[model samples]
Every structure is written in structure tokens, then in C-alpha cells.
Target: MYVTTSGRIHNFGAGPATLPLQVVEECQNALPNLNESGFGLMEISHRSETFQEIIDSAMGRLRRILTIPDEYTVLFLQGGASLQFYMSALNLLRPGDHVDFLVTGAWSQKAMKEANRIGDASPRWDDSENGFKSIPKNGEYSIRNDAMYVHYTSNNTLFGTQYHHLPDSDGKPRVLDASSDIAGVPIDVSAHDLIYAGAQKNLGPSGVTIVILSPWAMKRVGDDLPTMLDYSVHSSKGSLFNTPNTFGIFVLDRVLNWVEENGGLEGSVARNIAKSNLLYEELDRSSFWKPHAKKDSRSVMNVTWRLPNEKLEEKFLQEATIAGLGGLKGHRSVGGIRASLYNGCSIKSVEALVIFMRNFEQANH
Candidate 1:
């Protein structure tokens, strides 16, 4: 039952988010033999022409979908978004150069900790103080103009906070982790110096991180950096530095193509708005439940909520599993309920989950 989509199950896993039904069907055909090449997409050679086409198509569609300026180049590389945190820090920052990070939740906390260990860094506005419920609007922290980069996790998957309004840091290069929110909606990429997203949630799958960096940021990698850790080498080699994730790139291409056919970013954004709005509205209307993230900065991708108590949260998870909404439990660091509604999560899925929420509320209350 879990294997099939039509049995009224809705997957709410934050990473490894749901892929479109059409993509699954395409996978069925492409799995056996990709475009009659007699090799499945997973089995295709990464250096082969077929896989190159897949990579090119995916990168091109990513630019189109993200409205990435021609100034930035899209690179598909191995490693999740966490790898990107380290790489972004290492490539953009010199040993003693100052950097700014906005600590919002678990992902950024990891990013900050990792960046702190590597180079000079500072944080601007962080609201982990209020239990990660809100994004800092303005704060006393002074940003250095010559800062390497200002980093922020646009959407906090763990704590359900989002920066609906981005920070205004004059003349500073900015880096954003749009990992869980990529392609679910449109963004102003021009505002940031660089952007990185893991394909798992809204893009495609694990093992691939997509980056669009400014030409300036790309050149900052000095020869002293390790060859494997350098973006310049990866970009010069067309993300073919070492072996690329051929299968992940292939699926991402298909997913982005699906986004194009289904009305591109605007269509996905509208659908995502509807899906997340439904789930959040359910949480708002139910007396037995409450949203964890603040109202002004609620995430449209990951919605975290909780019952009155931990025991009730456990009970909700058990009942929700029985009801076929998989991976609805929150991250262990902030345990409760987290309904991840990414690009491919259908409105029908949200509707069924809302029904489950109503049932859970009734039973628990």
C-alpha cells in the first residue's frame, strides 16, 4: 500500500519529498531502457552523450525555473546541502575574512557551526531564542561591508520558520540555502550573491546539490583549496569533476521538465500555495493543535505543528501512520508533526491529511 500513490496516501517527508505521479510513470518506462538506449537511466554512463543531455537539460531548466541571471552558472554536484554549506564557506571566505550568518533553525545552526570551525564569521539576526518561532526583523548586529558572504537558510525545515522577507545587507554577498523550498515557488535570485539547494525536497532527490554562484564568488577559490572541494574546478569541468550523480541529474531533468509542462514556476508556486495553505489552515482551525512557526514567517514548504503534549504528539503520529500519511513526524530535535508540502505534493494529499487532522483532533480532544 505504501508503494502506491492512488491509495489516498500523502507523503510528508521533508527531504525525499514526493515526486509527481507522472514522473513515477516516466520512471517505470525509463527504468527498463532509457530512450531505447538499452540502458536504464540509473545504469547509463555519466560521461555518455545521453547522460550529458540529461545534465544539460536539468541545468538549463533550473536556470529558467529559478530565473537565475545569466551572470550565474548552474552546477550540479554530488553531496547534499550540508556539503554546500562547507563548500560555500570555503570557496567564498579567506582564512580571516568575516562572514555573516542568520541563525534560524537546525539547518542554519549546523551551517553556522560548520562555518565557524572553518573561517571568521558573524551572525546578524537569529530567533532560535524564541524557540525558532520567528525570523529576526532587525537587530543590533553590525555587518561588515567586506564580509565574505551573508548566509541564511531561507526555509527552516526543522523549525518551520521562513524568511518571507529577506534581509537587506548593503553591498554584501548573500548565500541562501533554499534546500526544501526550491522550485516550489519563485524567488528573486538577483538579490543573492549565490544560492544552493539540495534536490531531495522540491527539486529531485538526494546526493545532488544545485548551486548558482556569481562569477566573483567562483573566482575566490585560490589554488590552495583542495581540488575536490573547489567549485572552480567543478564549474570548469561542468560538474563532471569526479563522477557526477547521473541518476539524480536525470530525475531532476524530468522533474524540471514536468514543472515546465505544468506551467513552470508560477504553476508550481500556485499549487504549493494551495497545498500548504490547506494544511496550515487546518492546523489553525483545530483547537487541539497549534502551529509551531510564527504566522508572519510561516514556511510554505514545511509546516510544523503540535498537539498539547508529547504523548499526544506520539499518539497523533501513530494514528497518522495508520491513516497512511507517511513521514509526518517532525525532526527529532524538534519533535511534533511536520507536514512537508513540496512541489510534487498534490492538493489532494493535503486534503486527505486535513481529514486526518480533523479525525485526530476529534479523538484527542
Candidate 2:
């Protein structure tokens, strides 16, 4: 086996982001023989008591951290947040029923497209012409009172926009795709009828998606649905309808434990705010950089900005890589630099990035 290095680079990737070093070290120690089970974690059977305990621990910790109400059921499933786009429509909507979507960015637009295949999904309001720079204000959309549910993305990873406050659904059921900023942000769990997140950004890793649903939302799941696509089936079976991602759940368990120990959602949010503020402050202070999203709708988790020109942005990323920074490249849809400060990204890393930014600006200017 190759020996690992002592110091780690500051990672700013959008997804499959950095994980807490403590959680990674704990997983490493347990991988060889989990809980003294006499077998490696990957070798253990999912039905074994060892695996059962792991899943149960993960679920319990997530509930404690999020303060999820007892009436809501949490399921750890395979597909990422992308699957929930259509699954939400299939479960709660029929051919005639309609679902309203707030199209703020690329992910929500994809969700609405998927929902359209299932039912009469329509965009209540779209801000694409403005380059998805900000979220629509309250009462800006013409919501149909008879719609089945309103779908929105809590954070748009591609465009770097976030909703600081959730929309007033007008008593209609709210379906949120919170894949990018779920555990990193504090939320009112009771306010949403259904919420789903892919466990790659802030939670743990990919391959596991957490779906939390209220009792009323579960009741609306369509009958005769395929076993795999049915939320009610997964909830009834306790997210063990099929073989689950045992390793993913194990890592998630450790991550949630870390979150709770560090002060739960509130603590995560505080850390993220500090990191984002540090970077944004430097960006705003310099004329060499230009932020993508509006100040009011900027994402605390992902800060996207452009340099004076593409050549400078390329040079900055190349030099930043040599200086032990990684994943500073922006998304393909929008060309720029993006720094994703997930829960695991430390303040030290953000400070280093800001220092590098200032140096680069000074040298170039």
C-alpha cells in the first residue's frame, strides 16, 4: 500500500466534496474490522445485526441533528436527488394533477422537465433570462391553488444561488430538492411535506440519498406503483426494501455524529457563513473579481466568481493548484471560478484561499 501524505489540500469541489477528517479517519480505522465484527465493513452482510445497528445509528443521529419530527419517515435510498425529480411527481401526482415549479437555476429546471414527463408540471416563475442570478421574491409567481405541490431547489449548485428563506407555499405541499445544502443549513423540517438530498456535498458521499417525508405526503403516494419508485414502499420497509449502500450509510452515521458533537445544524451553518463571508469579502473588495449571483441570493456553500478575463481565471486556477488548492474550476454551463465551502471545509482553508486571491489580484493588477 502506498503511504499517504501528512497535509491535505484545500478542496473546493462542488459535489463529492471534502469530508470531515475525523469521520474519514474513523472510517479508515473501522474498515478493517467494524465494531469487532471479525470481518471488514464491505464484507459484512446487510441483514446482519452489525449492519442493522449501523443503519439505525445513522437514522437516529440524522433525526437528532435535524430535529426531525416523529411523524416524518427518513429513508436512505440509492438514487441521488435527480431521481426524486420524477419520483416526487409519480408518487403524489396523476395524469390530470399539476405541479408548480419555481425555476431559479439549472437543477430546478431539470426537475421541472422530469416532472413534466409525469404530470402537468409548469413553471410558476422563471428567472433564466437574468442568468439565474437571483431568486424570485415572494408573491412573484402565479401559483395555482389546485396544484399538487410546489417544487423548489433550496440551493442551485451550478448557478451558485440559494434561497435564504423558503417560499410560502400557500398551504400547499412543499417538495424541496436540497441536495447541495441540506445538512449545512438549518431548516424547519416540519414546514416541508417532502425533502430529499444526495449525500455527497455536506452529508458524506455519493450513492446514498436521504428522503424525508411527512405522513400526509406518504399517504399521497400512488397505488400500484413499482416497488422501487414508491416512497411509501421504502418507508414501510424502513429503507431496506432492497440491498442498501451499507458503506455509505456507515460514513453518513459517522458524519452525523460529528455534526451533533459540533453543535448540529446551527453549528454547521455558522461555520459555512464564516467561510463564505471571508471569500465574498475579498471578492467584493477587489475590482479584479466579479461574483455571479446577486448578494441577496448568493449561496453560502458555493461562492462563484469570474476573474477580469478567462486568461486570468485560467492562470489563477493553475497557480492555485500549485499552491495546494484544488477544484477551483467553475461549472461548464458557466465559466468562472467556484469555491465550495461545504461543512467539512475549514476556516483555515477559506483564509488560505482569500490570501491566495489577494496575492493573485495584486500580482495581476
Candidate 3:
């Protein structure tokens, strides 16, 4: 159940999750000198033929896996998903235009705050009262027909909650900050108008953000926004309108290729479900531990749980760390423990974690 090869259990931290060992090794060998070019990827010119190949291949592979339509363009840019809030608002909504925001967790709240910073509308949602314990369970979902665009965090990384299914908000363009869950599975791109993610979580490393958007969104860049701040213009001009994070894009290409080689999106999706099942089933079978996330709202990638109280939670986290399952500390807002089992963490790692949890329960409870 342990990664005896490296003598460490699989890591479950939320963002910047573990990547394939093969991919890591490949990078280690190539990084000292990239592709016989006598320089590391970081040292290469993004506009040079070598780096352009890496970036283009990344875009192609990502398109193939996601089945992105021709009408959409993929841009690898900087500033993380946070900056998308500004770009999205600027591109689509005017100063007084309303944007319907979904407040699901800390991430979504942050999105709203950022949205407000860029525009005047406030987040209108029912998820705040219970601290996002559960996604609103209403049988009906109504869209504010006049909103510029509907923004939602598809997966709440901090609280281990997810929209089990995409909401049916008719006729409105939907924007999702999929920073934590990008490349975890296949998505129906047709359903969304725009989607953005920080590459560090599951793509490769920090310093870049992947944005996949439809051509329809281009028309929505209603104002002649700032040169750098406009997505529609950026996409029209290609991502190379300015200097890019060359190495980040290269590493992203390597990781996306790794995902494809190991059975593509369908394969990754299967692995994620298997990994989640292994951990969730064990938690379900135990009385000593309970899941903090609601059953229906549970996050497949970020699983969170709590001990009896603060004292127990403290002991559990420390003990869990000593047991070699690192990055289990919960976000301050949630204050329990979070295990972000991203694509990189192997199945063996999760199995080891399950074993450790069972042992901890037997001894303490």
C-alpha cells in the first residue's frame, strides 16, 4: 500500500497535486539540458521553434482530450485563475451589467469578491448559511435571465464539495473557475461558454493558467478593454501577443502528454473514481471518522473530513503526517483536514493512506 520505491505515501494536498512518476523522471533527465538544446526549458525562448512546438503540442493534446470545438481557442497565459475574474468581467460585463455569481465555498466567495472588485453586481446565492456544508438542494434552479454571464466554481477545493452535476441554467453563458479540477476528467465543453484553470493543480506547475473559451465569447468583449486585459483580443491575436512563461508551458505539455499516454481523459477519469472510492469507502465503513463533505457534494479530488473536535483534529493531522501522508491540513476556513488526491498521487499512495487511517482509528477509538 506504500510507495516503497520512494518510501512515501501518496500526497493528497489540494493544488499542485502529485504528478506521474514517469513524467517527473522524464523532466529530471531533460531539464538538465532540454532536447539536446543545451539549455533547460526555462532557458529556452518561447518564440523559438523548440518552445513553440511544446506549447502547440500542449494545446493540441488538450484539445484532443477535451474534444474542444473549432470555434473555441485554447490560450496558455499567466496570473492564475484569480486574474480570470477580472478578465471575464471586463470582457463580458459592463460597469453596471449584472453577473450572476454562485457562492459555494471559500474559492467561490473569493471569485465573487474579485468580481465585485471589477464590477458592481454582488453574488446572489443560498450556499453561505451552512458554511457550504451542502450545495443548495433545491429541486429547481432559476437563472437571472439578464445577467451578463453566470460564474461558478465547479469544484470547491477547500471544503471538499463539488457540483455533482452541471446546473441547467438556460440561455446564459456559463464561466467556471476550474483551477483545481482541470484535466481530472472529460468535460462537455459545449455546456460552458468559458473555463479557466491554474496549471499547477493538475496540469504541471504554477505560473500559468489555461483558458478554453468559445468564439461566442469573443463578441461579448463588448468594450475595447485594455490590451492585456481583453481575452477576446488576446485569443484573436494568439497567446504570443506578449512574452509567456515558456517553461511552465513546456512542463504543462509534458504532463498533458503523460495523461494522454496513460489512457487519455477516460483513463484519468477512471483512475480518479477508483482512488476516491478506495478512500471514501473506508471512511464510510468506519465509525471513528466521518466525512466533512456531504455525500452528494463530495469532491472526487479533494476529500475533507474532521475528527471529533479541535483537539482530536490536531492530533489526527500530526499523526497523519508522521505516518507519511503529508498535506492533510485543512484550509483555515474549513479547519478540519483536506486530502487533495490530484492526478499525480498514485493509487498506491491512497491505499497507504487508507491503511494508516484504519490503524489510527483502531488505536485511538
Q: Best candidate per TM-score, number?
A: 2
lDDT of 3 by residue, 1-365 (tens): 22356664557777676777777777887777888888786677767787777878989998988898988878888888888877777777767777877778877777777777566655657577787877654444466668777788878888888776776556788898888887785678878988999988888888889998887787777766788888866676568878888878877888989888989888888898899889899889876777887899888888888876788888888887777788898999888878887888778888888898888788788
Model 1 quality (TM-score) = 0.95
* Model 1, residue 198: C-alpha shift (Å): 0.8
- Ordered by lDDT, highest first, the candidates read 2, 1, 3
| TM-score attained by model 3 | 0.95
Q: How many residue pairs clash in each candidate?
A: 0, 0, 4
Pull out the clashing pairs in model 3: 10-349, 12-340, 18-344, 19-344
Model 2 agreement with the true structure over 1-365: per-residue lDDT tens digits? 11125477888999899999999998898889999998797888898999999999999999988889998999999988989888988898888788999998899999999998888888988999999999888888878989889999999898899999979787788999999999898898999999999999999989999999999898998899998999988888889989999999999999999999998889999999989989989989977899999999999988999988999989999999988889899998879999999998989889888988889998998
For model 1, where is the 10-residue window of minimal lDDT? 1-10
Per-residue lDDT of 233-349 in model 1, one digit per residue for the tens?
888899998888887888898899999999999999999889888887887886688788879889898899878999999888888777777889898877889989898888888
User: What Cα-based lDDT does every candidate model obtain?
Assistant: 0.83, 0.90, 0.80
List TM-score per model, in order: 0.95, 0.98, 0.95
lDDT, candidate 3, equals 0.80
Task: List the candidate 2 regions with Cα displacement exceeding 4 Å.
Answer: 1-5
